[model samples]
Target: MTVKSKKYHISGERLEELQQIAEENMFMHASQLNDWRGKLNIFVKGEGVWVEDAKGKKYLDSLGGLWYKAAGYGRKEIADAVYNQMTQIESSPSGSATISQIELAGKIANLYPEKSSRSFFVSGGAEAVETAVKMAKKFSILNGKPGAYKVLSRRYSYHGGTAMAVSLGGAKTADPMGPTMPGAIHVTNWNSYRLPYSGDPVDVAIKCANEFEEVIKHQGPDTVAAIIAEPVSAAFGIQIPPQEYWQRLREIADKYDVLLIADEVITGFGRLGEYFGPMNWGVQPDITTVAKALTSGYAPLGAAIATKKVADAFTGGPEETFTHLITFGGHPSACAAALANLEIFEKEDLVGNSKKMGNYLFEKLLELKKYDIVGDVRGGLGLLAAVEFVADKKEKVAFPASAKLAQKLPKFLFDRNIVTFRAGDIISICPPLSITKNEIDYLVDAIEDSIIHLKKDLNT
Candidate 1:
């Protein structure tokens, strides 16, 4: 699994210029750009599962450009669609309707559950989450439950980065951003790898579901607007709950007369072997938020889809407008790109490929458990998976936070011309759906090599 590095050159002056611009103006997200400074590797191009840095070094992008890129990279069809749409209509007012937007909405609505036939466009996943939250609150009020404003989310769930989305997120990512939006309640997450209770998986799931019911009861069910959750909690280490878990959650939400919002930003648009995660789990959420793979990372676009009943709530007089709106909610070019991306998905049967390739990748990843440092390999049914490292496999003891394996492992893989993501001690491998069997082998080999190297370096 050796990575062949190619020698390429970029003008030193051009590199310095880019560095100067970044240092002077660019405020990076979730990054210490200042520390990176001039040493940062700038990717200039991408094709399929690979991206090339300015230095012409190619790296296999296992994370699929932050868990997007379902159609892989460098798709001329998507680009041409965007270009054609831009030429016809560069921009339209938020309130104004466009053909591309309407068509995209129809396509997405048809893919969703039968009840979910309405779509509200947004720029990205965070915006989609924000839109879903707003719709939930509005729907509650419209339905005569004005007190239903609280949203229940699972602990360690990652929604988005916007203030409202961050508040809805159960992770500690927004701790430093000051107090979260009021009424954002947190409950236990379903991470079997680090289960709080030692018992049968079903029993633990029931207990977790009971916790949700308890929270709703405590909060007063009438005051709860929605229970938002990711079908497969990707940010919390790809925690795939049992099928019973989702069924129970659906029942609980129904019992409390609360809307269920599935934040499918990661698992939507064929990432999880199905059209959507809810379909995969056989639970139909009242509202589903989608982004990322919607346009396959070729453009920024997201959608907040609602059941017909929910959408009908806002269809009254002129004054009954859904007040929540973004200036670029349904940019025509983005919608065109999304439509073209979906076309590729249909033509190439990428969803089917995701299911097949995902199973193969999962099987290969399990081989990593042979290593002493590889604590767990969790994933299947989709093109998403993670490898959790441990200091003691027998006791399931995790490495100290100071070890910084999460930060170090990605770098080690990057140096070897392989790109992946690390969350805490877990390394997430989510390649494009188009990735082949040989690429999966390459990815797993790189991961194993990096872990072995780190073990010796840390003398673990």
Candidate 2:
């Protein structure tokens, strides 16, 4: 298979019309709108693991459209489901229950652990986080410990962009708005590669878990409502914690009586080869938030699943309502799309494929370490992996922030007809779960060639 050169271009009235739209009203996330207003590649279509720009140049969607789209693009099954649902009923208020919403919630409950059997729907990941946070606090209050309102989150973790979600997130980019929500505490992240202690992986994991315990102790466990974390830190460079890390954290949370909230927005729906991230680590969180692949990016939908114990707390009297709602929390069409997406996952054995392809991709990525610029290649649990670059691999020295290597690498790969994501110096490659071995090889080869070209261009 011959890879096409990046020579496609657009012009005339169509280009002008797009430029006007892009420049006039569109404000992209995490971007300098002024600088990127007109200087952006407009994607017109997507199919399988590839996407085409307005210029008709096709590129492999290695990041799965921001780590969603696990079932791949152009899924007509999901489209048809959404269409049929819209024909019947487009949406319903939170006060009312829709059939699609009820079915999706039940399906999600049955899919995850029995403990997390009740769910609250929301529009997206951020809203899910917001909902989870509020539930944790309210649960504490209802349980008679109103002081338990602080949330412990790890540094470099990203929950979402809402006020509460942003506060829970520890990423620098997630904090551009300056002040965060109150009572959001930060703790050490389980980045074994950059661990302060040098020892066995299990020992390092123990040490990391100890840090979390210490924070709870110092903050006074009685005052802490919950501990929110990603099973495999995705937005923060795919930081896969040691096997012992999650179990240890779960034990600590249980001991401290703190609710464990697993933000599986990126790790749920078989992205990690398991139904949920906590399941992948063999630890069930009290509350699990899911989005992204829940509907395989076919539609906007997210959910916060709570254990029966937690949900039961808000029940009893007729006046005992959760007291929160989102207008489109349970859109009938979105729920229908999600149901169809999960059906495809089961029929195609995409979860099993994620595990198999993830292993293959991990081994292929390890080959890149032979390059002087490649520092680390981590990720094997499932189809989520990353390639971290360094100016000095021996010392693990990162390039200066001003260099903006992370921002530049994506464009470089894009020019070579490969689409991946970058977080600072770490490049992430998470293709659709349905990707074939041939497609994986093409992605890895393109990444290698791009790194070689980048090193030469930088004279490194």
Best by lDDT: 1
TM-score on alpha carbons, each prediction: 0.95, 0.95
How many residue pairs clash in all the candidates, one count each?
0, 0
lDDT per residue as tens, model 2, 114-178: 73589899989999999998999889888877799899898888998788888888877553776
Give the per-residue lDDT of model 1 (tens digit) for 1-460: 3234445445478778987898888876677775467776688778899988776778999899999989999999999999999998888764578799989998997777763589999999999999999899989988888999999998889999889888877776555687778999988889878876889998898788778899999989889999999999988888888888888999999998999999999999888899998788688889999999999988899989999988989999764579887888768899999999999999999999999999999999999898898888998878889899899999999999889876788788987789765545888878899999998988888888887889888887
lDDT, model 2, position 181: 78
RMSD of 1: 2.2
Off by over 4 Å in 2: 1-11, 175-178, 401-404
Give the TM-score comparing model 1 with the true structure, all chains together: 0.95
Model 2 — which ten-residue stretch has the worst lDDT?
1-10
The TM-score between candidate 2 and the true structure equals 0.95
lDDT of 2 at 148: 90
Worst 10 residues of 1 by lDDT: 1-10
* Residue 241 shift from truth in candidate 1, angstroms: 0.6
Error of 2 at 429 (Å): 1.2
